[model samples]
Target: MNAAETPRRGHCSDFEAPVYRNRWRSLALALTGSLLALVPAAPTAGEIYRCARQDGGAPLYTDTRCDAQAQPVPSRTPPTIAANPAPDLAARHDQRLQREHERRQALDARWLAEHHRAAALDQRIRQAVVEGRVVAGMSAAQVRQAWGAPDQVIPQVGDGAPRERWVYRGDRDGTGTRSVQLEGNRVVGSGRRAPEAPSTPPRTTPPR
Candidate 1:
């Protein structure tokens, strides 16, 4: 061969060597990537066990040969709950509930002191009877005539005598009085043992 052809041939061989090395390196990298992709995900170490019942309602164990006639048991695993910030969440919830309860109590106190629908109705009924709006020895019919109709009528039994109640509801605030006693189509004497107002208030009010 000529000198120039010899030098060209050697250069061509050197370049081809690098190409082969590059191809081998590329093949190895591809194989490594494929192997990594095919690897299975890891699993937890716990095993499952379940029990089956026999004809006599006895339990059969798994991974053991306790009963030959027992059916194969089903596999069971305990449930895994997600992580939670229970302590912090519970504290916040309790605090919110406390605040709400405090607010409700404050509102209830305000209503009881100012409006006091129940107490006011009781007072009005006592005042009416005392001032003769309801006559002392009146019948149920007479009471109805003076105060219109009662809001509720409750029939009662088992007192060894028949009994009934006539409830009068206040028109303005929906509060009222109840008269309960022996009934025979007409009331016998009631309002005799009726509820009384606070005795302290009577004693405290200076005679005027």
Candidate 2:
């Protein structure tokens, strides 16, 4: 070789040495990354925090404490309930209805008894009328029982007995007058009279 070629070859050798060094550095970095991937990561210690929303919204959970509207999470459990409860609503309702039914039954029985008593009293009055037992010595109530009410009752004085005459005047055309006399509450007598004659004098004697 030439004396000048020696220097040029030395410079080429220097450039090629830097390229090999760069390749060796890249290979070392790749091997270090693979080794790191194989090694297990350590577990991090974290605190649980609960964050509140602006309105009624989904709750947020985070490992770090929140600065706005946040609180540490608390443990929660379900509430305990009794196995055997008190009487239910349906049972109480049924009892109330039963009591009302009994009350109505009692009222119905009392009304029926009163109705029977009135009917029996009416029957006794009819029997007295049929037997013609409404007479002197019978009470005024007994007279009323047989004849119901009279059309007129007139009081009399200046007589043998303080008396009241009850008159039943038939409808017009002068049919007649049926009268019952009572001294106090006792019936003294009862009779019917012919219609008055315009020319005849009134009778002073009580009817027999």
Candidate 3:
């Protein structure tokens, strides 16, 4: 063909637009790949055991076994937790807990040292009750704990102390009634008394 009759592609031509855009895209892709290759491959978001689902959502990942397809993907973020505690660290933690327990026990013993005497007295009082005996200075509650409830409770405004007399039923063989005297809720004395005999009614004849 003659030079004047030569066919040439125009800037606005539809085919040239597409070809030019494709060439630029190819150059841009090459540049991007070269830059990516030089940049140390970005640590790959770490390897994981991924279990993909049929629902097309994100896959499940775990440090343990995977139940589904486990193809490693770059999108997975590694778990933050370390697999397990160091053995020495765990042992030290256990020892620290034991030491804390011992320290607390010692503190309790020191703090409640005065109450130890009261506790021992309470134990002795309980032992007295178990032996079926009431002692002087025994509280009303302790006396009840030793013996059962009294059959009669009589309050007296006495000269010494506002005393209360608790009388118990006489023995079945008519031995005697047991009594306890209390001064302000504490036992002062206890004794037995002869049982009162039943009085008989006098016989009378009908009007004959």
Highest lDDT: give the candidate number.
3
Off by over 4 Å in 1: 1-132, 135-137, 159-161, 171-175, 180-182, 186-208
Clashing pairs in 1: none
Q: lDDT tens digits, residues 54-147, model 3?
A: 8999978755445333455456466797678557988899999999999999999987985897787778878889997777778999989887
Report how far residue 196 has shifted in candidate 2, in Å. Answer: 27
The local lDDT score (0 to 100) that residue 189 gets in candidate 3 is: 91
Winner on TM-score (1 vs 3): 3
lDDT head-to-head 2 vs 3, winner: 3
The local distance difference test score of model 2 is 0.76
**lDDT agreement with native, every candidate:** 0.62, 0.76, 0.79
Q: State each model's C-alpha RMSD to the native.
A: 23.3, 18.7, 21.1
Q: Ranking under TM-score, best-scoring first?
A: 3, 2, 1
lDDT of 2 at 44: 34
In terms of lDDT, model 3 sits at 0.79
Clashing residue pairs in candidate 2 are none
- Model 3, C-alpha of 123: deviation from truth (Å): 3.9
- Candidates in order, TM-scores: namely 0.24, 0.32, 0.34
